[model samples]
Target: MVETVASLSGNESFDVVVIGAGGAGMSAALFAAIDGARVLLVESTEYVGGTTAYSAGTTWIPASMHMASVNRDDSQATAEAFLNRAVGARSSAAMRRAFLDAGPKAVAHIEANSDVKYRARPFHPDYLSELEGSTLCGRALEPLPFDDRKLGRAFALIRAPIPEFTVLGGMMIDRDDIGHLLNMTKSLASFKHAAKLLARHARDRIGSPRGTRLVMGNALIGRLLYSLMQRGVTVLTRTTVEALHTGKRGVEGLTLAQGGERRRVSVTGGVILASGGFNRHAARRADMLPGADAAWCPGAPGHTGNAQDLALAAGARFGEGALSHAFWAPVSVRKRADGTTAVFPHFLMDRGKPGMIVVDASGRRFLNENTSYHLFGIAMQEAHRTRASVPAYLVTDSEGIRKYGLGMVRPGGKGLQPFIDDGYLTQASTLDELAAKLGIDKTGLADSVARMNRYAETGVDPDFQRGTTDYQRANGDANWTGPNPCLGPIAQAPFYAVRLYPGDIGAATGLVTDTNARVLNRDDQPIGGLYACGNDMQSVMGGVYPGPGITLGPGLAFAYLAGRHAAARAASPEAGHADAREETRAQTS
Candidate 1:
């Protein structure tokens, strides 16, 4: 239940207090409440979803119940083998084993107990499908579309979708909807589907603030929020945790500030920090991620590392020396008419499409265009070490733009004047002219284009092997009749280019915790009455972006464990006190 600030008193208490109402925090609260614990979920912003509301809502979990239905040969051992190769020695064996064992149970429990439902993507390959033990399908799970009208007035609490992805200003569309809308002119069946969606959206705008048909991350958050409401969980938005109230036994409660009033809330179970991450925290980024900037990040403004700071102040240790400090992606920026900047993340969008290539400032192709976004970002970082490759360019031909669009420019979009005028996109009739506009070496760009054309004609990228893996081919345009779906000649006139920058999507290094999601000190001793999940917890993949939704999969699984464990401890009088004493002795020794 959503609570008002006036109802809160300085003397309020609960069995468990969860800080941050993102996917992890919300899921933790729901599981705890279902386990018969009095739970309170707090959010810094008025919205509940945080960065998750803006995501694709795909959770990459191997050996999930969703996978079981598809009859894939995925098991804990196979998943462990894949992680060992992909994550290498960066992550602990216990953490990887725990996630593989608990992921399916967490998904099944939530689905059976609440409105949350997920379906397996039949052909979504792991990001590194060439690696052994990586399956071609039945691992990634997408949340089913949800009707937000069920929440009634509470629906407003959910964060809205990004404007660029929506159509007609506020209507949300999923992958299937986009396909239908794109083919509406081709067939009567598609036309009917498009018409029906438009009609519902139009009607929805009349009585509602936004479209009620929610998809992607919004659907996942909506389902979790609705489940929390049904379980009678107390949720307070626009409330920030000021400080953790720690005693000799560890964190006993927290001091929260809401609307200029500070309130003290006591908790016996534990405090779970799931406040997205430190992506937007300037100091944290500067200290941990030296080259990254918050301005380039697309994470929610509330992810300011508040939870990480509070945990650190309470003696929680930070996970150090991961494969990378943060998850990365390439982002393009364009100023909107309202003066605010529109940042577009090129995730499986224009990069994998044919007739396009990302080139460095020297106008040379440095990496495979069909590689995963995370790997692409890493390559950008590597290039920056030797040259000014931070602001690389994604160059494509007129045919590419008309078919796949570039940045915020939609496919077949009319009136390209605004984009050209605003300088979000640049166009040139000749390769030399395009090179001049981009301020790069004309000879290098011309030679690169010639090589790309030769590769396009032969349907092979000998330099980088653009479409060798199932993962690469899956992201490419399947309708093209080229020898390789990801390779096409950029010989069309009026070539275009968009500047790209390496952006940190989320933090990978965070509070180090054990398999039970209990926050641990520098001595590897669990701090009593303290736990973490989401980005607040050090990533289980050890900062490696193995596939889509790797962050959320372990986040949800460990959060489930945290909730169950906290509730069980709260039910026992001696457990919490005894554990604190044991940890204290271990730390001192």
Candidate 2:
């Protein structure tokens, strides 16, 4: 059962104390609890599931038991080769090997012992599909839809997904559900599916603010919370870890503060730091992500780097030589009724669709619009260096807006007046007028649109090669009858546009850890009783966004390793510590 800091009697002891309650930390707590260790899960926020709850929860765990269900030809070797080609010298081979080795074991272990279930996505491809060894499917696993009602009152502990992402006044839906809902009137199977969802959501609205039928990230968190409840893991929300007490053996205990009361708890096993990352840490944000606007970042709030700071004070050092400090996405911002800014990431919805083009202030196409969100954000920053491209324009015609929508505007172009009034979306009847409103060069905009129309007829984007890759083509309109699914003439009247900014989705540079996820000091020696995972640890990909769910993939694998290692330590404290010290030394050397 979850309780506040008031539940602690000030004399409690635990075998494992996980400092964060996102997917990584919760999984660590579960892995420890299942291995017969008393575990305590802590979250500074009132709710659990940090940035993870806001995500799509697509985990890229290769060679799992579920992989064969989608792509039987995929293998660990192929995934490794893809990682090598994609990640290259950005990260460590040893760390990547550790992640690859433990991925299937971690998934199998969690499923066998808990209610957390996952199914391989039939068509989710690697982000960089053009690279060698990249498969069309089977590496990515999506969490099965979970009934949040099973969590009982603890359901409130799960973080709510972004309000804009829901429908019908808080009905959460997944990719499959979206298809059914969109095609309900055309197909019987789709109609039945849509009807069932609507009926359940209607019933759920009586006592709940949102639907009880959770999908995507909510389903993943719901399953984890339910499993944690069954294991009787002590979960403390709205609690902060004040300080870490270390001895010759390493982290021995920590001070926790909650509700104006403080308590010191002892841990015989270890402390796992999975407190998101430094995305919101003011000093670190300025130092690492210099000049990046905080309003542009859409990550969850609990990642203040408090735990990371505590670790750094204990001699921990951040990893070096990353390609980027954080993962990136081009996001569109809008003001909510609550007066808070809503930063919506443009991922796999409109950018690659037909009849769309992203342009700089000069109204020139700067990148392949069909590129991955990470690459698109990188392009924005690179283009900004040369000209005014920080707030780039994503312009589409009337047909595109009705079919794919623009930014915050929904499909079929419903309720667009409100968006226009709020200045979230800009609408104009012609390309020249639209360019004038967006402050783009009218001649450049006209030339660009003309080129796009010519490309649509020829089915080739010779300049940027938009639809040349598997991932890009998949994101385009498959049902589109045009010569190229990704290319459609932007000649329709009433063109629409939204401004885009590069948003840091999550942290990539973090505290250094060994293969076993043990935090390392400046000299690269393991802090015996200290461990880290998720964004709290240096990414195995060295800040490269190799594929879908790269962050969560290594996060889960290392969480498994940390949990199992902590449990083994609890069982044989002296022997486990000695073995770990030697192993870490060997690995580092």
Candidate 3:
């Protein structure tokens, strides 16, 4: 039964105690419970899914069983080669091997044991497909759509999607739904598909707060939560871990605060720290992040690095000094009708669309707009070193706006006046006027547009080589009849632009851990009875965005390893006070 902090009493103990109830924590608890361990999953907030629920719920696991079903070729050796080139020396060889080996096993185990299902994105290329060892497809897996009505009363616990992503007030659409809706005017089949989806959504909203049909990350979390329920796992909401009770035996227990009451809970298997990262922690962000404030961060507010802090206090070491501190993305901010700010991540939506160019304050293109969001954010950061590029501008014409849509503006949407009136989108009759409105160099913008139009006609971007790679081509407008799908003339009247800023999607640097998902101390020795995964542990990619699901893929894999390892250790006869003391002496010496 899902319990509230108020219902939980005095001293409680479990074989495994999970601090966060996100994808990683929930997956870990599910696996541990399935292994015959009493698992207690706790969440600081009323909801379960953290930043994961806000994502697309794709996991990049090479050579997974689902890939074979899609006829995609992948292997661990090829994946390791890709990591060697993409990650370089940022991550250790041992850690990379552990992930590459365990990722497919985790996927297979979950699929066989739970109601959670995933399908391979057969044609999705890696973020850096041109890099050595990167595959054109078969690495990314998306969660299958689920019926949230199965959760019944527990449906309220799943975090809702951002309002901007939904359609027709509250209807959640998957990637296939989006394609069908976008093509509804072209074909009768598509029109029927769109109508059926809308009708179902309408019927669902009659008695539900949101659509009962869940997709993407929401579907992944919902399936996992349902599996946990089936396994009889106890989930305590509105609970926070106050401190870790550690001794020579490593982490023995923890103090929990819930409903204004503090209680101590002992853990035998271990304490798994999956409480996300320090993305929302002000002090920690200032220390580790690139910018001064996390104003544009789209992560959950509960990701205050509590688990990382508790692990550090218990002698876990910080794995810092990576290539980048966090996984980066460029975001566009606007004020909603409710007086709250709406931060929308410009991820694989409009950047690669035809007739658009991302320019700096000087009105000059700096990087390939068709590249991955993480690389685009890195380019923005690099541009900021010499010029004012933090709040860069994405310029496009009226045709571009109508066909591809700018930030927060839907494709083929007719409500441009409202967006312009609210100052979320800027529009002008000419390029010069648009540059003037955006406070950029008008002459430079005019010249840049001329060059871009020439590139559009010739289908060749000599300046930055946009739309040159398979990865870039996959994200571009495929229906364009031009030489390059990503290229289109920006000659239409009434140009538009939106302000963009560097936003961190999640933290990459976290607690140092060994291959077993055990947190290592300052001496690089695993701390007995203590483990970490997800953003709480240092990313195996070493701050590199290899593909779409890089974060969640390894996060879930390591979490599975941690749960199984902890359960086995707890079941072992020798895992007592003497074993803990012996490991403590070895570390100390």
Cα lDDT computed for each candidate against the true fold = 0.87, 0.91, 0.87
Query: Which pairs clash inside model 2?
Result: none
Residues 490-552, candidate 2: write the lDDT tens digits: 988999999999999999999999899999887787877889999999999887887899988
TM-score of each: 0.98, 0.98, 0.98
Tell me how many residue pairs clash in candidate 1: 0
For candidate 3, the clash count comes to 0
- Whole-structure CA lDDT of model 3: 0.87
Q: Report the number of clashing residue pairs per model.
A: 0, 0, 0
Cα RMSD (Å) per model? 1.3, 1.8, 1.4
- Candidate 1 residue runs with Cα over 4 Å from true position: none
Q: Candidate 2: give its CA RMSD in angstroms.
A: 1.8
Candidate with the larger lDDT of 2 and 3: 2
lDDT measured at residue 403 in model 2 versus the true structure, 0 to 100:
89
> Tens digit of lDDT per residue, candidate 3, span 218-286?
999999999999999999888889989976567878988887878888888888999988888778888
